[model samples]
Target: MSTVSHALTDSATMLRRNLKRMVRYPSMTLQLIGMPIVFLLLFVYVFGGTLGAGLGGVSGGRAEYVNYVTPAIILMTITAAVQGTTISIAMDMTEGIVDRFRTMAIARVSVLTGHVIGSLIQTMLSIAAVIGVALLIGFRPSAGPGDWLALIGVLVMMAFAFIWLSVAFGLASKTVESSSNVGMPLLLLPFLGSGFVPTDSMPTVLRWFAEYQPFTPLIETLRGLLMGTPVGNNAVIAVGWCVVIALGGYLWSKKLFNRESTR
Candidate 1:
């Protein structure tokens, strides 16, 4: 077979292996999906009234808050899903699975690509679940069909970028536990951004940080798509960040994987 064909075949096999592992060990995936849903329910039912009331131009209610917060929650879902990728990659590393693969004749990149693709699939599913729950809880988006399609594209791009970063994290960690810990920032970043409330309401320093952070643009772009708020240049900025992150992560992961394989 040709080189590209061999690579594709190996990658498909590796993806199937990861998917089967996910099916057999489903708890982690479930937890990844559940955490965001809990946050959704908690914020919408618990703090939504006060928070929604605080928005500048929106009516004050839980229903209104759901619309604003759902985008953040969706972003969080992707972040949380990558945590599983880290764990899975770490497991393969620490358990000598990658070592076994190294001795075989297959595309070297397929090992990492399998984890990336599988995690992306899992992340998208988690996003879908979160959005479903958001809708059930009165999170109504104003997006038309075209807007919804754009939203999906933005989300896929975001997930792809983060999953690669997680792969790098997993490769960097020496232990599965450390791999899990390293990705915690991904989960907390949404909260530090414009996730729960308007950035303008934050104190000056924090507001500046929130405004400038990567998550803020991604969240704002999502909000603009779903709520019809002005997107401005947020879409371009968000895409730029995704590209940088994905490229950096891919390079780092490849370097780490090759270094380890040689050792």
Candidate 2:
């Protein structure tokens, strides 16, 4: 086989291996998937009506809150899913499995590639589940087929960016606990942005941060695609942020992986 073919084959094999681990040891994946679902239920059932009353564009009701919060929940799903990638990579590194892979005659990049691909697939599944629950709870969207497709594209881009960033976190951590801790910022970023509440509702300093954060633009873009809200320049900013993060994370992850594998 050619070099590219060899790399593809190796990566596919590693992908399968990681996916099987996800299935066999499902506790971590389940926790990651369940947290967002629980949050969705909690926010919609417990605090939706009160929050929705304060939110613009929607009247006061849990139903309105569901519609408003679904996009944020979907983003939360991505955040949770990428944290799983961090944990998985950290576990493999600390457990000597990565070292074993390094000793084999496989493509050097295959291991990380497999984790990225597998995590992307897992994240999509989690997103679908969250959306399904949202639909059951009266989360109606105004998006057409084209809008849905565009939404999926944006989500995949975001997931790809975060997955690599999480991989870098995994590689930089000396232990699984540290990896999880390192990824906490990612999990919390959605909450800090315009996900659950409007950025304008926040204090001046916080509102400024929320407006300028990367997640805010992505959340705005999602709102536009799903609810037909005005996206304006948020789409461009969201894509730009994804590209920058993906590039930075890829380079950082490659450098970390190479350095660690050599040791």
Candidate 3:
């Protein structure tokens, strides 16, 4: 087979392997899914009334808070899903599986590609679950089919960027524990942005950070598409950030993988 054909076949095989592993050992994925669900319930039912009231124009009700918070929660789901990617990659490295693969004649990049594609699929499922829960809990969106498609595009871009970053974290770490630690910032960032609350309501310093941070633009773009809010330049900014991060992370991950394989 030609080099490209070999790479494609190897990647497909490895992708299937990783996906089966995900299905067989589902604890991590379940935990990731469960975290967002807990957050959704806690914020919407427990704190939604007061938080919703605090927003300038919206009615201080659980329903309004639910709508406002769903996009943030969706972002959180992606963050959580990527944690699995880091852990899986780290484990594969530390357990000598990568070394075993190196001795094989398969395309080298296929290993990483498998992890990336599998993780993306799992993250998409998790995102779908979160959105379903949000809909069930009175989180109404005004988006039509076109808006939903746009929303999915934004989310896929975000996932692509973050998954590559997670792969780099995995390759850089010496242990699965360290990989988990490195990936934590992905989960924590949503709170620091406009996810749970409005950036305008935050103090000046934090407000500034929240406004400029990558997640803010993503959240705002999602909100615009789903809630019918004015998107302005947020869609452009979000896509730009995704492209930058994806490129940086892809390059970093490849460098790390090559270095480790050489060692």
Candidate 4:
């Protein structure tokens, strides 16, 4: 058989195995759907009244703060789903699940691809749910068809980037707990960055971190496409980040996985 055909067969078999596992165990489906929606309701209805006083009256403005929060809320879904995938992958590595897989006849890449694709499927479900709620809250996008296509492209790129980073952590972490622990910095970023509020209101020190962090550019670029705001040329930085993180994380993760497999 040709190498390409063999690779395709391996990937398919791996994907099928993961899909069957997910079918029998539906843990992620609920959490990914529930968590972000909870945040959206909590922040919008509970805390939104408070933010409105200074936010061009989010209560009275033509654009509801829900519109703003919706984007952030969508990100919450991405964070929860991706983090879940990361921790799960890390646990598999630490628990010898990956070792067992490595001993199988499947293509090496298929193992990672299968798990990543499973997580991506879960993310897609979460994305749909979030978008539905956003619509219910009047968070309509004025973007054209092209923007919608571009937005989907951005999301896929974002998903792949996180997948590689998660795989890297899975390979590098020595303990299952540590796999999830080090993500605190990543978790703190969106809140401290422009996701929750305008970075302009933050102190100079905080604003610098908020403005320059990777999430800002990503959030802004996504928000531009979703909200029709002028993200402009600044989006180049965001795209660059996707490429850099995916490439770097993937190389390091593959190396770590190779070393661990031999041990």
Which candidate has the top score in TM-score?
A: 1
Against the true structure, candidate 2 has what lDDT? Answer: 0.91
Clashes of each: 0, 0, 0, 0
Off by over 4 Å in 4: 57-63
- TM-score of each model, paired residue for residue: 0.98, 0.97, 0.98, 0.92
C-alpha lDDT of all candidate models, in order: 0.92, 0.91, 0.92, 0.77
Best by lDDT: 1
Which runs of model 1 end up more than 4 angstroms from their true locations? Answer: 56-58
Residue-wise lDDT of candidate 1 within 32-62, one digit each (tens)? 9999999999999999988887774556689
Give candidate 3's TM-score.
0.98
Please report, as a residue range, the 10-residue window in candidate 4 with the lowest summed lDDT.
57-66
Candidate 4 lDDT over residue span 34-149, tens digit each: 87888887777777666644567424432466666676676667767777667777778777777887778767887787778887887877888888987886677778888889
TM-score of model 1 vs. true structure:
0.98
Model 1: per-residue Cα lDDT at residue 66:
93
User: Where's the lowest-lDDT run of ten residues in candidate 1?
Assistant: 52-61
